[model samples]
Target: MRVVTFCDIDESVIDSKHTIENFQSGCSGEAQIAILDINSIFDFEENKHEACADKFTTIAIVEDDSDYDAFKNFGIDAWIKADDFSDINELINLIEKRLFS
Candidate 1:
């Protein structure tokens, strides 16, 4: 699986389609990015999550409600509230179990 991040993102998050496509592993792009092609003709949020379900996963961990609202608009698969966990280890354990189990 892959995780792609966009700094200073806009509400039109789907605009980063090319960046995601070129992120596939073993892709021969200029920067040797990963190209996990799900055979998508166009990059739309509707099938994007499903198309890359096996190849990519998006997640966010926010410390504030405002942050959560902002990140949620960015279309991530999962959101972990930092406040829900007491410490980094506990948070990490939950993440590991969620991802591996």
Candidate 2:
């Protein structure tokens, strides 16, 4: 399985690294995970781009309702609420369920 995470710049660097490490050690079966920042794909002038859209199984870490449409428009597989989840383990579980189940 290939897991691609799309997040903001700050979260992209920190959270993505953490998730990658966890997923590498903890994911039950064979899987490869990669992370990309939304900013890396989109500039302020261009809110959306096909390169990012085509290259990822985008998982948006949403805190509120603001970016829901944007992520959905980008064809994200799932939206994991940051505050609602306890930790990366839970997040991994969510991702596993979505992808495998």
Candidate 3:
């Protein structure tokens, strides 16, 4: 599946395993997985739904638990507590799980 990241995630780890792409702006076309930060949500608040209203899943990387409520309001499918992930593989594993679940 195609995985697009809009945050600080490094794509080199999964470059050969999955379709990991880095984007400077919001998702436009078919997006299988989108890794976004809080800023991306608020920055694109006006068109958040229209951009990701399809089968694509948005995974927010947050610094605080309170952010979850705000992200939920925007229809976030899954979330990762910023400080919780120890490495790229762990994060990717969660992303995969969220994609299929």
lDDT of each: 0.37, 0.42, 0.65
Predicted structure 2: lDDT? 0.42
Candidates, ranked, TM-score: 3, 2, 1
Q: What is the lDDT of residue 20 in candidate 2?
A: 40
Model 2 CA deviation exceeding 4 Å by range: 1-56, 97-101
Clashing pairs in 3: none
TM-score between model 1 and native: 0.32
Give one digit per residue, the lDDT tens place, for model 1 in 1-101.
Answer: 22232221221332332343332222222221111111221232443443343444444545566765555554555554545423423433444467646
| True-structure Cα RMSD, model 3 | 3.5
Q: Model 1: which ten-residue window has the lowest total lDDT?
A: 32-41
> Please, what are the lDDT tens digits per residue for candidate 3 over residues 1-101?
56667667655655466666555554554557777888777644554444443667777888898888778888777777777544545666676686556
Q: How close is candidate 3 to the true structure, as a TM-score?
A: 0.65
Write out the backbone clash pairs for model 1: 23-34, 24-34, 24-35, 24-36, 25-34, 25-35
Q: For this target, which candidate reaches the highest TM-score against the unseen true structure?
A: 3
Q: What lDDT score goes with residue 23 in model 1?
A: 29
